[model samples]
Target: MSHDALFQLGMDLEAHPAPRAERAAGPRSTTQTEDTIVAPVPARDADDRLDHFIEKQGIRCAGAHLIIDLYEAERLDDLPYIEETLKTCVEEAGATLLHIHLHPFEPTGVSGVAVLAESHISVHTWPEAGYAAFDVFMCGDAKPEKCVDVLERAFRPSRTAVSELLRGREVA
Candidate 1:
């Protein structure tokens, strides 16, 4: 089938809502009460071009943003460590790291960002609460999930909550 045909098929599938049972059986819920939905996107053939499909489908951006909450993180106050881990996460996600910047608060806590060719990964820590907020956004062929392992290993949070969003989706 042509790229436009395949893209149209995907749009048609998305337009129809899934059955309640199918939606409920998606990814398990974390500490948060809300259940995460995992809808399957139609796969492209080997010869199909991703950019063409996205363009034909009126998709503004092929990207994902992962909003993560790290509770009881062990190294919330470690600036250097957080910076290194952010860089590592970008690398592990197969994203090219353009630059990294970190700022340490007066007494404790840290904030950092790792700019990537795909997008960016950032974090803000609150040592007093033993918590950290992370935003991992990536576009193109980069896999954002690859950075999850790095965050878990580095922070050692007692409880982690994650919410993912497909950014720049088709409006109509």
Candidate 2:
């Protein structure tokens, strides 16, 4: 999408009505003056505005980055397997894969990156620790969360934690 469209979306989202509570409260504190009167504080609706903005934007929303931490993983030592799994994950997520690079450690472990049109997915594994860390970042219509299922299936981790962050959120 063009920057102008994005800017318009932000503007549309910002045009929310002020809360009734704030409007009813009016001025909480005022200074008494003979010739000068203090101005009332403006209603603070930053949190409400942000919530409304995100809601209105919907799927046309900002990019998403999924940070995954896996423990007791089964295939941290297999570089080739990891490379293929990541490719499949990217495909399943409806993202276009541009390129992929995989690296193997001296004796064990693997690291790989799969570049995509929307963004990228990267993995760093520690075979000795049975752990792996993955970053899946995608913008536009791509669904980064879909990759989590692929990761869980391929790695067979005993425990997993995932965090989803909205990247490049515009609030102007």
Query: TM-score for each prediction?
Result: 0.64, 0.64
Residue 51 error, candidate 1, Å: 10
Screening candidate 1 with a backbone cut-off below 3 angstroms (N, C-alpha, C), the clashing residue pairs are: none
lDDT per residue (tens digit) for residues 1-172 in model 2: 4433544543331234335664465523222222221223334465532112232137434477899999998989887798789878877987777777677788888876787766789999999999999999887557788999999999999999999887656544
Per residue, candidate 1 scores C-alpha lDDT tens digits across 104-154 of: 788888876777766789989999999999999887767788888899999
Give the clashing residue pairs of candidate 2, or none: none
Where is model 1 poorest over a 10-residue stretch in terms of lDDT? 28-37
What TM-score should be assigned to candidate 1?
A: 0.64
